[model samples]
Target: MIKTSFISKTVSELKPSGIRRFFDLAANMEGVISLGVGEPDFVTSWSVREAAILSLEQGHTSYTANAGLLELRREIADYMHKSFEVTYNPADEIIVTVGASQAIDIALRATVSPGEEVLIVEPSFVSYAPLVMLAGGIAKTIQTANENEFKLMPQQLEEAITPNTKAIMLCSPNNPTGTQLGKEDLIKLSQIVKKHDLLVISDEIYSELAYDESYTSMAAIEEMRERTIVINGFSKGFAMTGWRLGFVCAPADIASAMLKIHQYTMMCASTMAQYAALEALKNGGSDVEEMRSSYRRRRNYIVKSFNEIGLDCHTPGGAFYAFPSIRLTGLSSEEFAEKLLMEEKVAVVPGNVFGDSGEGHIRCSYATSMDQLQEAVKRIGRFIEKYKVE
Candidate 1:
């Protein structure tokens, strides 16, 4: 008798996240220093936690409105206007979701039709392509290079667009690379976006973690507000990863469509998480600054150390990761990462897992403690000494 295949072709074809592979490997091994996962070493601020506790105590345990608490939506609108200079009506233009991941998911499901193409800029967050495919949209990639600091160029964006293209996904203060596009860079890309009349899904979860320069939202660009959906959350900047809260801001029509899908699937975000996020928006600025400062310090140390040890890492303008070229070792990225994990017990993600252009490099997250980072660097230096090609 033949056995039935239960999984859908889409789910079966999806590749596992490369970041988690090394993380799981390091988990089983003792004495491993993992720089693999892109999570904060800091705990969620006490006030945020207290708010959640207080809400539970006050019997705010019931489900919130499908779009989330009206109060929270108002707070999000205020925060977005204040931080990014982008404005959205709280009533119909914002929807709080389970996390930024869900915000991206519903946005794709709402906007993309079968066979529609979404241009994904790489090295991108791993979820974007898979989410597009799962939504019955084709994921097309525009590979960015280290030569240009891994930023998406306007020319490249224009060249990648076709008649079937429906939208583009962007992540600034990007995962894996930590690259942030400036206002001028965004203006250039915005011109291309308008020329092609495509929608943009901008992930700004790391907006507050910017180091070298102020963060700019793509929706803040002239005339782009109507065409962009902003995805942000309390995960990175507020050290609230465990809270699992995020939100989306878009035009009323698009937001309504996203809300319809979210209502059926997620129902509502956690009421307690929503209350905690309210406290975060109202009073978590100082905590965010402290964590940002710590990440900035770690960024400086890790990049300098990587370069000093001959790894040739670029100074990431934002986020807590350093993408360094491991080409000197003359090994594939997977080879280098696997061998390093096995030999030195140091876990860093291989670059090729991000995209084709990411080969010959590795992404080391500086979200770990300073002492662990120092020790990991030493171990990596030793591994490099052993593997470096003459």
Candidate 2:
């Protein structure tokens, strides 16, 4: 019999993902409408899939450069330049990763030393803190509130830094909240990063999903090119989540470090997926726009419906989520979500799972079809009315 103590203390101490708890509950039941997962419902565009099929047929099964295929890397570089106005050398300054998630993992491992601290702006992605800990760095979660639309302000950034602080993880078009940091906000943050000499890991996975305003890359800010590590992928924007394709773009020194980790740990992303992503970068623009338009409409409808039902959802600026405060019902976020699932057969993630500041809220994804979303919202409304306090 294996002893539990043989497992790494770090691995044993990590909390299981909260998002999966509701997902697991819903999976066992019938007639459940789930808005819990963050993945896009859209299937990979046909052209991209076709490219992968073609690659497999050609027997290009062997690995390319450890950094990734030069041709695909060149296409990625071009796309970054055209889309965000940030240029990275395909040869030495970019690495193709398994997903944006792995890009984040390797980037943290490369830069953060043991006992150093990485400031995570929350309520953000669940993976950031765990990844930092896995890399032997301390995770410091800086909670941001709804009043500021969940955007991390300059003052907050200044207040959170300490001598042990080595880096900051930022998510624009944030996962649970769907709020984004604008150009002016990025400039303010860049100034702070400069003063504190902190590395910035900018997760721009949702960059193409912004609605009202164009998304800005932190790496595009003046002098930020050297300091910012931009993490992105085809998962959200291109609906290629299952393809498991993502990349990290950084300055040569940092990129080299991350590439070393990738070479040993991942040994290059899947060859077929890289080819698929190349096709996405080349010909998937229209498909991306089509899906983005659908998510926009769904976002508008879902946000409006939540507010009308007394849920008080802040209109998401980007991404396919609507985060609604569930405090008015006087139910804790977990209680509300669990009851809603049991009684109404509707599944949404408890907001508190994102962070403590998210305690009174719940995250509702609008990525499902309009019909499913419509049904989920109706069920949620009925639950809210039934549980209304006073």
Candidate 3:
């Protein structure tokens, strides 16, 4: 009998993703309307797919360079410059990764050392803290609030920093909260980061979806180009979630270090996906704009509906998510989500899974169809009325 525990304590003690738990439950149920997952509903644009199909037809099936193809890197460079006004050298400052998730993982692994700490802005993505822990760093959180629109405050960031702090991970067009930090917000944070000589891992995955203002890269900030590592990909904006392609851009030294880790760990992103992403950068702008327009419309409708239904939602600046307060039901986030799912057949992620600051809210992905959203809102309103504290 094999009774020995093979799993390391670090991994064994790690909690499973709360987002996936509800998603899996919804998957097993019949007639469920799920707003749990963060994936886009849009199909990969035809031109992007065609490029991959052609690459496969032409028998380009071998592994790419460890840092990805130079051509794709060049296109990515151009896109970064044009879109976000940041410049990266295609030769040494960029690496194409399997997905934005992988890009984030490698970034954390390369930079964080054992017992060192990384500050995470909470009400953010589920992956940040776990990745930091897996990288042998402590994940200290700076919790944002609904009162501040979930934006990380400069004072909050300053208070969270300590002697052991090495870096801060930021997700703008943040997951769950859908908060997008403007240039002024980032500049304020950057001043403190510079003062403390800390590194920044800026995840700009949803940059193309910003509705109210232009998306600003932390790397674009004055004097921040050297310290910021930009993580972005085709998944969110290009509707290419399955393509599994993302990239990282940093200063030459940091990019070189991350590339060594990538060389040993990932080798390269998919060659076919790289070609497809090239097409996405070159020609998929209109497709992205069309999808963004649809999401903006849905965002407007859902936020208004949640407010009218007494959920007290704030309008999110970017990302296709609506994080609404469910405190009126006098239930914890998990209880609210579970009851809503069981009684209403509508699936949402309990916000507390994101971090402690998310306790009173629930995350609903508005990336699904408007009809599903409309129906889900009705079900949620019914569920809320049944349990309203008043």
Candidate 4:
């Protein structure tokens, strides 16, 4: 009999996702209004789903090129250039991935050698640090604060870098905090990255959902294109989360390295999903705008609701999340989340679960219906009013 202890130490030591734990609890309880999950509640548009159905009917169910269908890659390349002003050669510079999640994983695995350090900007997505560790690298963090709208500062980036640092994991319209990086900030940060000779795994999955200003890609910066690996997918922008399709666009050499790792592990992203994504890239702009506009309205409503309720939430520039300070309740982020769930039947993620910088905050997703958002806010307001010590 093999011992269970034979599991890799790194895998064994990894903590279960805090997001999943709360989501699971919410799933079991009846009538719980959940604002915990990051996925959009909207179903994939009928047209996109219909494309996948047509593909299946046409017997298009087989493996794609290890780098994904050339047509899809070409569409992705075209989209990046037209939309974000970032260009990539579809032939050798793009590789379709299982999800943006896997793109992040393989990018880290391909670049980081054992004992190398990857600087993560914290109050970040839960997966970044774990993926770095899985890649045999050390996860060093620079915590971003509210004063900076949770955007990573150049000084923080500079101070956090060391001789051992090889790369930085950056997410814009960030998870946990929906704040994004502006062009000026990216220009400053790119200078530091170039000076230090660092790689960037840029996650821009939320780019299309941005409000007011259009989202900026670090890859769009001059000279940063080769240094940046851009990861995006249909999930967020096109309301296709269940489709599980994503891609990584990078320099030819880096893309080749990532593709080598991906071929052995993922082979290629889903064929049906690939076809659907191709359809999406070709014609899904209207659907994306429809959803993004809805999210923006919800964002405006919820940001105001939280402030009115005394939570001090920062109005997010993009994404479907609102990070609100729960400090007045005199409870830790976890305590506030737990009590809110148990008492008010509203589920949200504890900010501390994201990182120490998230200690006094809680993340409320606005992806659900406006009715649900309204009710959740009402319950939260009542709960805070009744229990908050201040």
TM-score of each: 0.99, 0.99, 0.99, 0.99
lDDT of 2 by residue, 1-390 (tens): 989989999999899999999999999999999998898998999999999999999998999899999999999899999999999999999999999999999999999999999999989788999999999999998999888888898999999999999999999999999998889999999999999999999999999999989889999999999999999999999998988989999999999999989999889899999999999999999999999999999999998999899988788889988889998899999999999999999999999889888889999988999899988888988888898897
Local distance difference test scores for all models: 0.94, 0.93, 0.94, 0.93
Better of 1 and 2 by lDDT: 1
What is the C-alpha RMSD, rounded to one decimal, of candidate 4? 1.0
Model 1 residue 123 CA deviation (Å) reads 0.7
Task: Name the runs in model 2 displaced over 4 angstroms.
Answer: none
Q: Better model by lDDT, 1 or 4?
A: 1
Off by over 4 Å in 4: none
Put down candidate 4 lDDT per residue, 225-310, tens digits, no spaces: 99999999889998889899989999999999999999899888899999999989999999889999999999999999999988
Candidate 3 TM-score, C-alpha based: 0.99
Estimate, for each residue in 1-390, the C-alpha lDDT of model 3 and write its tens digit. Answer: 754497788887789888888988889999999998799999999999999999999998999999999999999999999998998999999999999999999999999999999999998788899899999999999999999999999999999999999999999999989999999999999999999999999999999999999999999999999999999999999999998999999999999989989999889999999999999999999999999999999999999999999999999999999999999989999999898888899999999999999999999999999999999999999998899999
lDDT of 1 at 291: 93
